[model samples]
Target: MSSVDICEKHRQQSTKTSFISFAFPYSHLRPCAHRCKQYVVGRSYLLQLQPKNRRNSHFSYSCEACQTEARSTSTENNISTHALSFTERLWKTYTNTATLLTNLFPLWTLLVAVLALRRPTTFTWLSTPYFTFTLSILMLSMGITLSPRDFKRIWKRPGIVILQFCSCYFLVPFLAYVLGRLFKLPSDILAGLVLVGSVNGGQASNLCTYIAKGNVALSVIMTTATTLGAIVMTPLLSKFVLGTVVQVDALGIAWSTIQVVLIPIALGMALNRYFKSFVDIILPISPVVGVIATCLVVGSAVAQCNKLILSAGISLQIPIFLLHLIGGICGYFLPYLLGYNEVVCRTVAIETAMKSSAFGFVLACLHFTAYRVRVPCAISVVWMSLVGSGLAVFWRYKPVQNLKGFRSDLAQRLRQKRQLDEMK
Candidate 1:
């Protein structure tokens, strides 16, 4: 043909070749491009979807699609890593047998004490200074777990603690007395039950409060304050309730309580102040220690079951023990009706039901050689623990309807304020 035509044909061929080469890759890239476009759109949609001011910095759509994907993958990895670490720690702390032992120590101690009672001659050492020393160790551990900061918080909000003490000292005792008379329980069993009801809250109160999503700080303060107060209040209330049946040495009981509860706790708190690190290290182990003590105490009590049965007779005293359960349930709910919140009500309820039965056991051993009086104390420890723990678990997972209402009110108020500011 012509030179110009040939030049034109050559140009067309070059253009066609370039188009074919680009098209081959372009077809392969379509899927990736589409995915990138979709990811960008999805991110934008999510960004626009968030509540005002609630969108996090990482959630912003300023990055390119590839960068956004990388950021999301990083965030997911971080979240999964954190979650796994948390679960591992939780399993190590709670699911382990060591932790269970810590939680059940008190029960075990009581059990051992009771079993030793079966052959009092064989385990005479339990009645010696060693028993007192062991109890003192438990008290000290409890105190170390507490901080002055807890007391300060309680001082700021004293209402709940005061209410808990009132319910335990006044209301519960009155109910127990009235019920004991109505039930016509055996004189010894009634006396023991009344004494148990009159005493302050147990150390387990803190654990239950924590489980129930109640105020741990408040529970701790109440436990500490009431424990100190119990030295006086327990005796006076006991005298008032049990005086008709048996003479109670109010001052003597007060001294016993002080020796058992106050001295150990004070020693622990003092040590914690001086050796803060030691306290911190032992704090986690405190629960384990407590569990062992509990188990020992329970086993000891159980070992004396024959004596308890002989002195109190299961039939006669079973009714009194039942009254304790009923009284506890009543005491727990009454406070709720009197305008107290769930946490305070739970604290009061548990405190009202469970006494330091270990103290009661000591008193029974000192005052009465009869197993009848001690029977009630032995039963109190196991029953209160089982019931209180059940209640705590129930409350912990209970639907948080009240919190939802509070959040709703807060949101409404914020919306109103924003509208007002706009008008201004």
Candidate 2:
């Protein structure tokens, strides 16, 4: 029992309850506030808290909790503050469990990859079409969570978004090409790396941004912009980069990307806009659903290419890891040096580093000239998930106390301009 409840237990049952109610001199007291909730006992008696009880019209009442502590010999305080009630405890447990599961995204992906390698039959049963369907579902889950307001965030800081877009599309792809070639990987493996680099940012980046306490709204905006642009960008980049190595089916890739990624996301946004009530009901579970879909896609890809992955070993693995790690490093430092806030730096880094491996896998499987290309996509999924999530967890503990950055006058001018715009 709470100390207050225990002390008030016996006295409450009896009509004559003695509470400490002091009458202050008029000058000593200000106005009485209801927030104190100091007069329950006094009200019943109509003797301590009432106006007639006042001499110079100044009555000061003690808190019930304070009265309980003063009267009781017990040391425990109220359960509301120091202790949690049944429901409160239950809710806390549930949230903690959810956060734990959510943060372990890398573990789940890695475990499934290991299992797929050891026993391909487990995930191999889920065919290419299933992976494709799941990717569409993942895209749809992201789409449902987006609204016009998400797009509007771009207008608030067009400069940051533009920089982020350039970083994601330009820096990552260039890094992928350099790493793939510098590692002296085979033509198909190089193609795979290039394909993964060309794709849009994954929905997973949004989750990581949220975990890192970065600009989640900006992350979502960047994700949406790139995803919508992927239809054109993915095919063109693939054709240009892989033209000599493989007969790139630019048209096929574009058409399939539209069917797999664009259609579902557009449909989802339309549903969210037109059927908001239904969307609200499912919105809470969408992120979990997206995670499940993402896991399935990654596991399926890894299982399908287990023999190749086993053969490639670290020779292939090093480039894939560098593809993400270097991309993320460049993503963060570019923004930081240019004077973006830490939150923006984190958001841009995650978006740039984390490829839509699921989407890349689908495209590589569907349209690539060589089967080995899909192997990189599969491994990229595993590596990017690990790298992005690891960075997020590392940054999560390091809280952002200052919104303004120290590196550049550009950020200050931007902030001042935004303030002026808001004022106007």
Candidate 3:
């Protein structure tokens, strides 16, 4: 099909009969320009390049025969080379369609929340049991996506993880407390806001990080760290902040956190490690499943608080919106100020801005249901998704430039010291 094959065939025909005639078209001309007399095929030459130093610069010529043979062999390795069975092909199609749907989660969440506000009855049915199940699926999706290498990234960069952990557990919660008080939100709503901040980074953080072209592995690791830490941190912090307002059950909160976040994720990771083949089949649809679960969770919470939302003034919305807005702004700035790379900064920003609202809702339902606290958690979910998605889209186009700062300076100094020590 290629010039190489054509010339090879022509050379073989000539060897069996006579020389290649000049009347033959240029398309079938031999690669070796020097082999015109009797058209005896020249030995395959070494690779030739015009400007060898510049990879982008074109001009490569080769006729090793090995190259052609290697390419043909690689073709067989491609899926297209083999006959796929009907089910195999059908499954591939389903996964592909699911993946396409998954990318529309932001739009889908916004739409479902709006719908739930109108018809509470429709979504309210996805109640307590559904909430737990959906949240588990969301976390499970995150779990299966991960590998041991993802956890290794945590150890590879513990400092960044620490910063993220502190930001998630400390900075955001403090901001929520201050914002709630500053806005003079209702006591129950204040408790809800605090609960929102106190919980771990949402599974959605990983998706947002990926959209922003951030360090996804680092995001996943930070997510895992924050989530595991949340079991202890969330209950204690929520109690500390809301003790005066309500009876905070620290142990119940801790157990619920373990049930919702820890167990499902651990089970997912175990499946990934031990049963990779099964994981692979389901991996494509994992995000889609998470998105569906998230939408259902969002819809249910919004539906439950439908009357509250309809009657509630702008006073209720401002603090929750501001919570994510300010958290996202500061989340990005803190890491950038510390001179972390743009990707890491983006990852931390998303993780800080987006708390596990579904998890928060479940907790509020379990413990603070009497206080009508879950309403704020529902509201927080909608707002944070919008805020984080907006940031991801905005930063996708905006490039980070000349990021010279403390981190870079520190690296430089370390390199210099190492060089001096070597010289000595």
- Which candidate has the highest lDDT of all? 3
lDDT (Cα, 0-100) at 191 in candidate 2: 86
Runs in model 3 deviating more than 4 A are 1-82, 85-96, 403-424
Backbone N/Cα/C clashes per model? 40, 0, 0
TM-score, candidate number 2: 0.75
Clashes of 3: 0
List lDDT for all candidates, in order: 0.64, 0.79, 0.79
Error at 205, model 2, angstroms? 0.7
| Residue 66's lDDT in candidate 3 | 41
User: Between candidates 1 and 2, which one is better according to TM-score?
Assistant: 2
| Residue lDDT tens for model 1, 1-424 | 1122212222343434343233222222122222433211123333243444333323322225455578788899999999999988986876586756644543555455556556644444355245555666667778887667877877786766777778777876776677677777778778877777777777787777777677677777877888888878887876777888877777777777788788888888887899888887777777777666555555454445546555555664555456456656775667666556566666666666656666666676655545577777777766667666766778888843433333455677899999999999
Best TM-score among the predictions, by candidate number: 3
Q: How would you encode candidate 3's per-residue C-alpha lDDT over 1-424 as one tens digit per residue?
A: 2323434533554442222232233333444333322222332211221234333333212333544665786787665545556667887898788767776778998999999988889897887988888888888888887777877778889988999899999999899999989988778888888889989998888778888888787888888999889889998997788787777888899998888888988999899999999999888878788888899999999999888887885788889998998998888889887887677778889989998888898998987756478888988889989998998898889886525645896788899999999999
- 1-424, model 2: which lDDT tens digit per residue? 1223322433364444333223332233322233343222333333445556555443334445555555563445354444557777886786676677666777888888888888888887789887788888888887787777877777888888888777767777888889988988888888888888999988888889988889887888898888888988889888888787787899999998899888998889899999999998787677668767777887799999989999988899998998899889988888888777788888998998898988888888888768999999999988998999989998999988546664655666789999999999
Displacement of the residue 102 alpha carbon in candidate 2, Å: 2.2
Off by over 4 Å in 1: 1-125, 128-130, 310-317, 369-371, 403-424
